[model samples]
Target: MTLLSYAKAMNRALADALEADPAVCVFGEDVGAGLAGLTLGLQQRFGAGRVVDVPLSEQAFTSAGIGAALNGMRPVIELQIPSLLFLVFEQLANQAHKFSLMTGGQARVPLTVVVPGSGSRSGWAGQHSDHPYGLFAHVGIKTLAPATPTDAYGLLSSAIRDDDPVVLFAPAGALGVREDVTAPLVPVPIGAARVHRAGSDVTVVAVGHLVHQALAVAEELAGEVSVEVLDPRTLYPLDRAALVESLGRTGRLVVVDDSNRFAGFAAEVLAVAAEECRLLAPPRRVTRPDGAVLPFALALDRALQPAAEQLRDAIRAVLK
Candidate 1:
């Protein structure tokens, strides 16, 4: 029922969660001033106690979230840069994520670690430009990347409510996208994949911001071939059933992911398709080159990340 930017949608989602549940709290560097833009006005509405700002110690604050979650608080920790995740990997992968299973399901950590602007953002360079969702996914942590404003709002709400630890990667590419949403904002269930466009010739599985590029490419090739655009909103518990169903119809697959090619999210999708799906040709993945470190130069940075043209070429080759 409103038009909202991707960043505003996430801000609204956080506000909604805070208003709806008293137990839901947020902590991160600069959240008090809403530096990431997703927490703007939240600290004012919820007060400093609930929307607290922490020191610069990412490792300490990340584990503090785990501790808060253990005490029945739903804590959302925002990382200003995507690579900050690496700084707190042990806290998340070992402490928060493993609590539920390690305790034999007796304890649950409802913690949401949000990377607001992941992937290369112009000249942010190597340290700030990493899209590391695949790393979290490989560790079996609940991972999500919503491509649209609506999905951003819905999925973030769901992630906060989930019993397990969830990591949300809001790509820099999608941060500026705005949508005219008529329906009331609501939670989108995790582990569900949405078919953005239906087609019979090929299925293009796109992750995070790449979903928009995939849809655009699908439309551009509409006359030549029917390309199905599939968005697996949740990366960890990937909607394998939906993937298999799409593959059943399309018989071909091409994945566009922002992460690196080696053991990346796209690689996992291709690997699964190879193991279980019937394909007309060898599947292809469009991702950042293996071990790619985005450079400070704009052209060099753009070259390292997967492009729409690359996806189109991959789709064309897959259909060939």
Candidate 2:
């Protein structure tokens, strides 16, 4: 078995996609140099035309990607940092996302935006530490956050082939995750949630990299509480059926998300659980504070983000 790191998995997915499809191409600022590691060696193998490096302008390159998608080219845009997503919000949310709906399904923008390092990086401070996947999900754009190396490869492969616009966030924390690969990588469906560990006491729905934390917490509390760890790999188009099924067995819910508290991904999960499923007690969520800004200090950053301890407490509280 081979050990595959998350970033490498994404790199492999891109390589495979480029090799399989003549229309598949990539665009970014330093992609030609393979600066982000995900696009490493891609330009050399695919040539400069397919892996084109553009200006530093995020908006300009993003707009170009939309145009390419409209003209039958499947373009993948790599934004090195997550914060740059704010710069192209209008282009993604208003333009690329609306073309199919506004045109009555006539226009299809097969654009894939990948943020290799999303969420808080050490000392990156407030400006560069935003995890805004919820914002895109709110606007009806397909959003993905893969927790492991396998999902990273599978989801990205599927995203590149999707007809509509898709945004996939590879969390800064999960980038280092490595998996023991025993089989050939395959495309993961867009709206499936994987239950990493099954339990009967409570179901802990974790998003993105927090899936790891939830699994760790579940292991630690195994003797006392039976915690089921559920990873919502696809943020938007959430697999509500899986969620409802998990809740049916456990009758309790806790969501751990990296986004802010108000109208965040966790909030939406809680709403869905409360509305369609029966609960033994009020569901709880462990998430970053309302409108939280990560301080420059790493300690403060850790404190603001959701922790395993917070998850543990929520799990215990629901059992009371």
Candidate 3:
């Protein structure tokens, strides 16, 4: 078995996409130098033309990528910082995402935007630490947050091949995750949820890096409570069927998301559950406080983000 790291898995996925399709091109700042680790060695392999590094303007380059998509090129834009997404909201949300529907399916924007090291990074402070996947989802953009190296590889590959504008957020907390690969990497379908562990007491829906925390809590609460860990890899076009099925079995839910609590991705999941599924007890959500801006201080940052203990408590609360 080969040990694959999450960052390496993403790099490999990008390399494979570059090799498989000439229409696939990468555009971003410092992509030639591979500062984000996901584009490492890709420029050398794919040549400077396919892996073009653009000017330091997020809006300009993002619009350029959208234009490239219109002209039959599948462009993958890598934003080194997640908050840069806020800078190009008009280009992404109003322009690229709406083009296909506006044209009545005449135009397709096969653009994949990758935000590596998304979410909180130690000492990166508030500006670089935002995990804004929810905003993209809210605007009807296809959003992905893969929790593991394997999921990272598969979901990224699928994102590159998608016909619509897609955003993939590689959470900083899961970047160091590693997994053993015994099979060849393949594309995982979008809007699918994976049940990491089976349980009958509570179904814990974890997003992005919180999937790891949910699994650990499940193992710890094995004797007293049966906790099922469900990873909703795709934030938008959520796997509502899988969610309903899991909640139907357990009759309890606890969503642990890295985003803020108000109108966040976790809130959407809870809304879906409340509307469609019958629960034995009230569902709980463990998420960051509303309007939380991560502090630069290490201790304060850790305190702001969701933790394993919080997830454990949420799970138990649902069970009770």
**Predicted structure with the largest lDDT when compared to the true one:** 2
Report per-prediction Cα RMSD to one decimal.
0.8, 0.6, 0.7
TM-score of each: 0.99, 0.99, 0.99
Clashing residue pairs in candidate 2 are none
RMSD of 1: 0.8
Estimate the lDDT of model 1: 0.94
User: Please, what are the lDDT tens digits per residue for candidate 2 over residues 35-129?
Assistant: 88789999999999999999889999999999999999999999999999999999999999999999999999999999999999988999999
| Candidate 3 C-alpha error for residue 12, in Å | 0.6
Writing each residue's lDDT as its tens digit, candidate 1 over 5-72 gives 99999999999999999999999999999988889989999999999999989998888899999999
Q: Which stretches of candidate 3 lie over 4 Å from their true place?
A: none
